[model samples]
Target: MMDSGQNKNETTCAAAMNHRVTCNTFEPEGVPVQVRYAIFCGQSGIAEYEFYLSPTQHGCVDVQLDWLQSAYHQVLQWLNLELASGVFRRFLCSDPHNQAPELEAHAFSNPKHDDPPCAVSWVGQPPLPPAKVVLWAQHIDDPKGIKIKRDGATLMLDRGDLSHHWTTNATGVRKHSSFDQTQCIFEDYEQYLGKHDMTLADHVIRTWFFVRHVDVNYEGLIVSRRELFEKRGLTSKTHYIASTGIEGAPPMDRAKVAMDAYAVGGIDNKQVQYIEALDHLGPTHVYGVTFERATAVSYRDRKHIFISGTASIDPAGNIVHEGDVSKQLDRALENVDALLKQCGASLSDMTGYYAYVRDPSDQGLIRDRFKAILGDVPVAVVVAPVCRPGWLVEIEGRAIIAENNPQFPVF
Candidate 1:
């Protein structure tokens, strides 16, 4: 077993991304498939695995699931770590005439073009090893439907039906419209955190809402979320966390939204601040939405910058570079850089990125452009459309930079 003290590997933690923080990508030897694993060591001496797991084979649903589990276990055993939270992203197929049939296709496979069935965005930790790191997990109605991992303070919750991401994904057994279902999901997150001595309003640092058919369901989600936030003392007049509402299909019959989130409990208010590149982008409230452009959370030794889903928009909330994917992407990145600059960080500090393009044919353009610019950065490009039709693409990501501070706690 590895020592409880800072793992000997810390000596090798390269100062690639920033001082005191190491970042690297390697393929675990034993796994039969490809697993792109990124390791980022915290200044407080914690080993965190930020992994995007996928298989090279674009096959059937069962094959993808089996490979996913196998790849997952191989890494866990190889590193002697435990799984925390996971987001299982699948290629959704739709039948033009039938929602029921499309649901079957989503579960099975699209007959014509079999896309990569599924991939997982998962986080792992070293299991404490009798040290200061505290960890545990929580499951909802269907245990297999969700995966969650958390320390007492930093929580990563993923793929839930109804705390960090109590998604309605596992709550298909309940009959409700998208709006009522969103209400139930948010309530579940709040109550679950309450039982654990945490409150959603205080701890939730970031949230991702994956809506199926974003053009339609996103409205209900926004309405339900805005109302819930108001009740939780999170309003336009007060403050809200960074968030992304994009097109992602939930994994259950009659389900429409899946959620993933990160929260830090018992954190100092002074350590957190909202980022608004007011010169480049407008406040979300300029429309009817409620969320921050980015949120920066500081620990004793590092700072985390959560960039919400950003797109091409002017300070007046008007869409820019409409109908042009390349220009839109450029504008989005410039906006992201502007936001990160406020915290002495930039796009290069991003660990993971998700690019959602409304036009599937533009996938190659998005992929090539990012590859040329970001080089080796972990990016998941999906065919999910943005909430607005005028915008061709939207980007969201997380970035961490090392810092030296006599703060309250380590990240």
Candidate 2:
């Protein structure tokens, strides 16, 4: 008897075929499959596929691989059929979450060949036409965080919070920084940025300020930081760089600030364009560029805008809309919306958001407002203080415009 969610037609046919051949014959139509793929940096392509028992049916439910050796031929035939569907250049199939009782497909790599680690499995396949296929054994230490083949030839490790990266094929760690230096500010970085064909003026798109004792005459510190940038030939005034400054105890308990920058030469869209205030509104503090704060960086093909760290402060360096965090938050959201609109996008198009609150207690209040404003968007909320003691909240985001709209690319 087949289960309700099982492939009833396939299973029934297999059963008939089994009876005609031998009662012990193996069958291939007894599993479910899932697939995903992406191309990065216009070069490397990654594809993944998973096979498992159907939700409503049970096949080889309690049997281990050792018991299925006699039926290897049937399993191989099924795998071949999966390959014929033409979705993957590389194939990866396994029991994710290890829900199975015992054994899985053949491990992909052998450690003896100096290949990355792979898992031991009962089924395996070599690279197929159009692309190479390598098997990886799931990382046992962190099943979810690591992927490796038995031979160690194929391996993918998750580096969380360490950095954001695209494809190694296009760029290999092009930008990086560490807080090990005695001073947060680097002198004579020209020799350094030149080595990578980048400079302060090229693509320093975003900035983050983490300093100590930020509440002690913080405005003075902001001016000093800006001067430092100017000394490096990076004029903060007209640079059009997005910035963020916050007070945090770094590796050293002293005042230290770091920056993350982006650079791409010969790119005009990369050139900064300042958004102006409405003709009669003096200067719109709601969206004017400011120092010691993270700014938004956008690409031409992608409608999504990336706003660094935004807080509740108006022009003249006065914290406006305070006391009521929600009011302050509303103002900050408006600022973000303005930037998005400048790029032909809207708040509703946002797909990812990060919220940092100065007080943990404000989470509930913020969540209620977030849901009401965002209406079920993907978001992560954390509690972290702003560089100013009086500031209560800071929020940043990444948004993507809808597909089929000629204006932007799918993020």
Prediction 1 TM-score vs. true = 0.74
- All candidates' lDDT scores? 0.61, 0.37
At residue 122, give the lDDT of candidate 2.
17
Worst 10 residues of 1 by lDDT: 126-135
What's the CA error at residue 173 for candidate 2, in Å? 23
Poorly placed runs, candidate 2 (over 4 Å): 1-184, 188-191, 217-221, 251-255, 269-272, 276-300, 315-317, 402-411
User: TM per model?
Assistant: 0.74, 0.49
Q: Write the per-residue lDDT of candidate 2 for residues 1-411, one digit (tens) a residue.
A: 122233433533443332211011123343221111111110011111122211112243223232222222233343232222121011111221242223324322111221333212211111111111222111111113332221121122222311111110011122222232212343323333454354555544554444434464245446554555566655534544555555433322222433333333333343244443222112322333344232333332223245656666555557777777899788778767766676566676554455666776775688678868865443334444676667787787545432233332211
| lDDT (Cα, tens digit) per residue for candidate 1, span 1-411 | 222233435423454233432333335443334444444555555444454454454544344445555665555555555333222332322221233243233332221222322222211111111111111111112223334443322233442211342222323226467787788777666765676566767778888787767888889889988888889898877789899888766655466766665555567678888998899998998799989999998766678889999999989999898788999999999999999999999887876677888887786698778878876566556677889999998998778787777845654
List the candidate 1 regions with Cα displacement exceeding 4 Å: 1-12, 15-34, 69-175
